[model samples]
Target: EGDFVIMGTDGLFDNLGEDAIAARILQAYNMMRIDGKVARAVCSWASQALLNDAFNTSLSKTAITPFSIAASEELDLAYSGGKMDDISVLVGMVEHQVQA
Candidate 1:
């Protein structure tokens, strides 16, 4: 019975305002509903949107910055250095039931 789903980046939860995230979610929901796509597809789209937004607004251009290919290394270093901020998520929904 569900119409839409959401997949989001950690940045949206950590840095962006809730109102903004809500608005985006609503927008994505409407889009998915209109297109008749499944919740998992919608979620994938939404997650990419969140990451794209973050990449666009990031201030650091260093090749080894946290948002770059070095993200994994940076995360490891942060863990060792006692920086405990970690965020990763995935969301999906089933739009129809399958018959056995």
Candidate 2:
């Protein structure tokens, strides 16, 4: 399978960590496999999963998110959960061209 890339704004990171992001992408990939969707479709499904997770996490008051942990560790702040923000997610894979 070809490799895929995931890109997002700070808002995305503010709620989800690398582990969470990877999990969502993996879920989407597996789902595509079951649905008969090509690998390229994985990116589209993954992006939606990521966006939904981040947006939901941002609204939580008790969730320990990446940003909250960073704030506590780096700034000694008492942040406990993700802040509501404008989340953006992009997922894609490079396609190879074959010459006849």
Candidate 3:
């Protein structure tokens, strides 16, 4: 399967949903494409953004994301209400194969 993959820990998903994460990654990827650069820096930035979003979601008092709900229900009460954990994200871009 030659496809781009984004592998992340539960902490990453606990705060942000798939749609949000996809949008962020697409934003980062587009930015890098416009800059004519594709490197680890972009990936790192994306990961940091995810972490920040997660942390902020945890702090927000107004609304709770579905991810947070699921996450809380699955874990201890201490982490029941919000997303407060170690976030980790990894993005892998697949290059087109060269035909022989």
Candidate 4:
């Protein structure tokens, strides 16, 4: 199966759960397929979207704080209420095995 594998740091996981991540990735994948998108483009879009979504979610007042009170306090001065942490996202689309 040529499935897409998304790896990210705690910063991302704390803001977005597996289902949220998967849904976004799947939506991106479908859009790419429809537009005949290349792997690099897909990966780039997925990475950027993941990062943005996490950042935005962290900033939302309704969202539960992903960081500890101390951590949130430290970050609040910088991010102004957003969770602060290093966020790294890598998306790998596995190659499909083609039968001869």
Candidate 5:
């Protein structure tokens, strides 16, 4: 069993295939696990990275834009909107059993 995680930009998710989002999330989870990170942490990291990237990247022609604040607000709104769009997440766990 593997964790299926989905991380997406709102633009793509709002306009395109939902299944593609699911597939990409699962793919990301798998890749993260392969890279030696746990599912939950991976998800958190992904979200943080996405937010950071979005904040650093400009979204409009305005030269003085608060990208990070805007991105944070957008994410909050999306979660509240209940539109069921693709969001970033991590899945699964790895256990190293120890002898009792």
Candidate 6:
């Protein structure tokens, strides 16, 4: 129930896997819960976290990324490490109003 709505470009997914992305958002979710704040309050922090992670991963020579794996098997090419590209990430939350 605390998960956020994440949207991004190919660069984001290319550098990071599902588990890496989930951990970042979950950290923000947990922090917001502890602070007793709305999910929206941590949106900025979560987005930044994803950006930093993706950027780091993209630059890591030893880090295996989704794009690398696909390029290796599907494309039958010799590819290693993360792929550098234009990454954009957005973190948001949905709020609902219950009837009285």
Clash count for each candidate, listed in order shown: 0, 0, 0, 0, 3, 0
Error of 4 at 25 (Å): 0.7
Which of candidates 1 and 6 reaches a greater lDDT?
6
Q: Write the per-residue lDDT of candidate 5 for residues 1-100, one digit (tens) a residue.
A: 4534444466333332444334545655776758876667766655554444333332333322233335447777422111223433333334456799
- The global Cα lDDT (0 to 1) of model 1 is 0.51
lDDT of 2 by residue, 1-74 (tens): 35678899998998999899989877876777688787667888888889999999999998999889988999
Q: What is the TM-score of each candidate against the true structure?
A: 0.50, 0.87, 0.69, 0.72, 0.33, 0.87
Q: Lowest summed lDDT over 10 consecutive residues: which window, candidate 4?
A: 62-71
Report the C-alpha lDDT of model 1 over 16-89, residue by residue, as the tens digit: 34555556667678878799866667777776665554444343343232333344565664311111234344
Rank by TM-score, highest first. Answer: 6, 2, 4, 3, 1, 5
* C-alpha lDDT score of every prediction, in listed order: 0.51, 0.86, 0.69, 0.77, 0.44, 0.88
Model 6 lDDT, full chain set? 0.88
Best by the lDDT measure:
6
lDDT computed for candidate 2? 0.86
lDDT comparison, 1 vs 5, better candidate = 1
- Candidate 4: deviation at residue 5, Å? 0.8
- Model 5 misplaced regions, further than 4 Å: 1-31, 59-100
TM-score of 3: 0.69
C-alpha RMSD values across all candidates: 8.9, 1.7, 4.2, 5.4, 10.5, 1.9
lDDT of 6 by residue, 1-100 (tens): 5447999999899999999999988888888878876776689899999998999899988788998999899989878888889999999977676799
Better of 1 and 5 by TM-score: 1
Check candidate 1 and list the clashing pairs: none
lDDT for position 20 in model 6: 97
Candidate 4 global TM-score = 0.72
